[model samples]
Target: MSRENTLLSASNGGPKQSPVRSNSSDGEKSARQRSQTPKVEFETERVELKKSIKFSGALAILLGNLGGASIFIAPTTILSLTGSPGLAVLMWCVGGLVTLSIAVSVCELALLLPRAGGPYIYTLQVFGNIPGFIILWGFVIFIGFPSWALAAYTGALYMLSLVYPDCPPPESAVKLLAAWLLVGLVALNCTYTSYVTKLQGFFTMAKASAMLIIIISALTTVTSDHTQENLKHFMDNSNTDFGRLCLSVFAGYFSYGGWQIITVLMEEVQNPVKDVPRALVSAMLIAIFLFVLTNMAFYMVLTPNEALQSDAIAMTFGRRLHASLPYLLAILVTLCCIGSVNVVVMGQPRILYAAACLGHMPRLFAMLHYKFLTPWPATFTMFLGALYMLLSGTVALLINYISLYVCIMLLVLLLALLHLRYSHPDREQPFKVPIPVLIVQVILTFALISVSVYEKPHELGFCLLILASAIPVYIVFIYWSNKPRAFVHLVDSFTDFIRKLFLLELPTTYINNHR
Candidate 1:
């Protein structure tokens, strides 16, 4: 006390020694430090995904993603659920609008972040690490891997259908072909990024043209009286089953899925903020028109009962034109499936690479082919997962699992958008979805989730169980361990050997500098 008094006396010029001012200065300094932490982390951890995708490339990816085998299979399902051609058509329109609205919201977020992980990156940035990790896990397991497997399986099935028009192929044969297809696609993607995008562009153009020709030819040519009778019952919803109608909308929405593929490649696009939104909107518009017209063409050719009865609606529609047309359509459907598989193979690995760079997974996944700059390790992981699905012969079950998770993830994404608006108000937003539109998106998202839960509670529960399994993974790999483990090191060595064997280029610097 005597020493303190003497020190105070030495500063007697400020006899009022204000503790309040000193405390306030300390608080300000601490606040500044806290604010700068995230800024520093963001600067240090900024991962750079190659910006090679141009406007045309982006558009091609979007179109390729939207025009998958869904177009060939989903129309009949929608018609079956609605029990009326008119309502089914209306459901497609409504589904498109809902998808477009969600896309608009996603476009806003993509502009803000413009990163590689799509919703994973968005949710992580807006909410935090755990939420992002959860979404990433769900995406890789549910959407990405299952989609690749399903496409490959369906493509193989269609290929076999062409080989054996009268009889179905053996399940073992289908599985083998599907596994081979998955491998081939993975190899193509690992070779060169530009080549893959070009392939996608070509596929999009060819498929769109083929669909247009089919639509126009079908609409122009008159069908039998039975087909006309189907059209006459277009409005007859005597059953008026609301649950079935909701399921029809769900099917339509499923067909309208994959529009978010553009967002996942945000960092790859040349002008992500401008081009991504344009590509998304334009692709969805084209898809909506094509889907509705194709359904109209289906009604033009076959009765509702016939459409419901047929396993392959597109082939049936084509058969109406000519006897040989069904085979051609089957081949076309196979091509569509291949294109879809290729698109997923191209896009999904980046999410894994992005996760790895963020320290959510092994850093080996973050490795890029030095010359091609493709994420080969991540691509290989996806290939392995798809191959497992093919071998397990659970393509349908995997698809059902994916559907529930898709709805859940979309809901998470929409919530992320809203949270970003409130939490990151000052963040640069080159494009912003209006609040009202976001609200509508929220409503639609909830409705979709509700339908999924109500219609398939057991499936949803199973998905939740699978998602819960990620908790232990997160606890061990991400939370408990900061350093790479033995298996991770083994994977790294294997990747290195592959690189040397394949004559792939080596990194010029520490690849994980961003980490």
Candidate 2:
């Protein structure tokens, strides 16, 4: 038999079909067996991801992703929308609370399902293949890639600004740098999956340290004279721009965006049942505390106008403390963005791999590298999508596009939790969120989408276009059950070629077993 068939058969739990010729000497056959034994054993043993991420690593990932450069950059947008330091601060608080509630609800789903793909898996398990496809579809095109692009874009912009303090950097330069950052990080993820936890730990520490310095510096500068002055006009510019305000809240929540990412990696997390919840809650609380303080510090140090007009809020705030602080702040914020991109690189491809394992995607994506055990095909595919977005789209446009669908999907995932509770009451739920919290989340999420879409029909129309585009693709590739033999041959040949080229193989844990 052929090599592909032999590996496939072994992975499928069938007896190994050794290609031993009858005319071959016994000595040659024995040598072949010796060479093959270790490989077959390796493939069979490492079917699932290794549980390498401990509690600290999990916390680092959640915090690193949540406390990305958004805290440094998003304050400007929020302050602009609210037009008041106090209300802007309030918006951050509200966003954090809402996100925390969403994370709690997701915790139940993560524990119950306890697999890769995070929200994608939760939706797939409860809602079946088509709805699952929609979630995965939105994630790949809308949520996942755009997030990486935005971080890279933000990072590149800040880095360039540091280099050219006198003039704005050219757009081409920014895009080029962003592309390089994305490529390098993707390569790191593909090459060294085991090192991700270490990277996350270091990045999270740098982020926390940077935020702390800013917060302490600002607080020390605050005194009785300016304290009352800052507080007196806290609500001075607050007004009702209902639509833009919703977008501001969206921005605030965007800062807290990646809290759910660890769920996708639960399979790789050690002590997932206990550690997942701990890491999520702890990271969120710390993020909220620091984010709110950081914004407060910005307002206290600079006037509302100064805070709004400045391109880099953290840099501006840092410069007040010392002339050289902006340079340091720029470097730290750039690292924060890189860390966020790293989290995305490490987590998002697992969604594609999980989908492929379930037959929702091409089988090639499901294959793991023979030696590294990383999902190289899915990782590289995601890298290409993110690179395209980085080169093509701007920061503001990507934010609007990503936030709407993410809210919609969060709403769906919460609804799925409720559905699972009702439908599978007898199911073993290691964690249970209060129904009221879920209900409130549903209401708030729906209201956010409704108001934003209502006020901005143009953005809503564009988002709907991207969303509806998935259905036709689904019908053609996934929904259709029949295909000509030639098409089947073509697909199989392509899958085989890529598998052999990359030294990839299917995992022993197939989709049928998952269901």
TM-score of each: 0.85, 0.90
lDDT of 1 by residue, 1-515 (tens): 12332233334332232223444645776676465455433322222456778989988888888847777765576777777788878888887877787778778877877778788988888878877888898898888878888889888988998888878899899989998999888888887778888888777776686688678777666566765676777778733677776676667667788887887877788887678878888888988888888888887777777788877777777777788877877777787788889889988888887787777877667666644677887888889888887788665676767656777888888888888888878777776788788877788768877877888788878888878888788888789855567876887688667655543332222244442
Ten contiguous residues minimizing lDDT sum, candidate 1: 1-10
Model 1: colliding residue pairs: none
- Candidate-wise lDDT, in order: 0.76, 0.82
Q: Best by lDDT, which number? A: 2
**Residue 67 CA displacement from its true place in model 2, Å:** 4.8
**Which candidate ranks first by TM-score, i.e. highest?**
2
Residue 478 miss distance in model 1 (angstroms):
1.0
Q: What is the lDDT of residue 211 in candidate 2?
A: 89
Residue 180 CA error for candidate 2 (Å)?
2.0
lDDT of 2: 0.82
- Sequence-dependent TM-score of model 1: 0.85
